[model samples]
Target: MLLKEVRDTLGTEVFSKEVERAIEKKVRLHFGGQEVYVKQSRPDPDERALAIRAEYNMTNRRELMERYGLGRSAFYKIIKGG
Candidate 1:
């Protein structure tokens, strides 16, 4: 179920807790069925910036709408120094 669907169906108060569990379940389901293997992969400091932007672009519309209340969009727009 999509986050929006979950929120709409369950209401905000109940949905918050449910959503956390839902995400954990997804992560577990994805990994639990696979054979585990360790691999060394050093990350670059620049990667976090890339990841932040990638997440911002990919996050749900429901979250971005909430940003309007907190002026987060404006803050991001004027963000000069990371």
Candidate 2:
């Protein structure tokens, strides 16, 4: 089942202590025949910027970094073909 389905059907409490701990550590979970890969809610800034740049001619690095919550060095690295 999708994560949302799992959450809706079982409620957030269905996440056991082990699952919660795994999520905290950003680890995948294998429970009851399901392999759950927990991920961040937001896309990585560099990834988002790359997509935006590809789709649109984004020229403002500062604006893009600020909008995506990226550090200056990381943003530059991503923009510079990292």
Candidate 3:
């Protein structure tokens, strides 16, 4: 499920506490010495656009739309605009 789905299901505060407990339990049992680095930055918009453009040019647009969960006309507009 998506993060939004999880938050909606469990509520934000409960979901966060559950996540913290899960991380602690998992790390304590399996990872004793390692450091976990979770960062705030993952997606880059410029890179994402380049990837979408590349896919639109090289792969099936239908598959791309499915992967993005975008409608045909909307996806086409985005591909053509970029």
User: TM-scores of the models, in the given order?
Assistant: 0.24, 0.38, 0.40
Lowest summed lDDT across 10 adjacent residues in model 1 is found at 73-82
Predicted candidate 2 versus true structure: per-residue lDDT over 1-82, tens digit per residue? 4454655677677865566556645534335456657886987756776775664346677776777676888776676777
Candidate 3 stretches with Cα past 4 Å from truth are: 1-46
Task: Tell me the lDDT of model 1 at 27.
Answer: 70
lDDT digits (tens) for residues 1-82 of candidate 3? 3455766887877778668567667767896888867687655756765677787765588888887666878776777775
State the lDDT of candidate 1 residue by residue for 50-80, as single tens digits: 5444546545534643643325564354332
Which sections of candidate 2 miss by over 4 Å? 1-40, 44-49, 55-59
Q: Candidate 1 — which pairs collide?
A: none
Which is the winner by TM-score between candidate 1 and candidate 3? Answer: 3
Q: Report the C-alpha displacement of residue 34, candidate 2, in angstroms.
A: 24
C-alpha RMSD by candidate, in order: 14.0, 9.7, 11.3
How far does residue 17 in candidate 1 sit from its true spot (Å)?
Answer: 6.8
Cα distance off (Å), candidate 3, residue 53 = 0.8
Report the lDDT of model 2 for residue 29.
36
Best by lDDT: 3
Alpha-carbon shift of residue 6 in model 2 (angstroms): 18
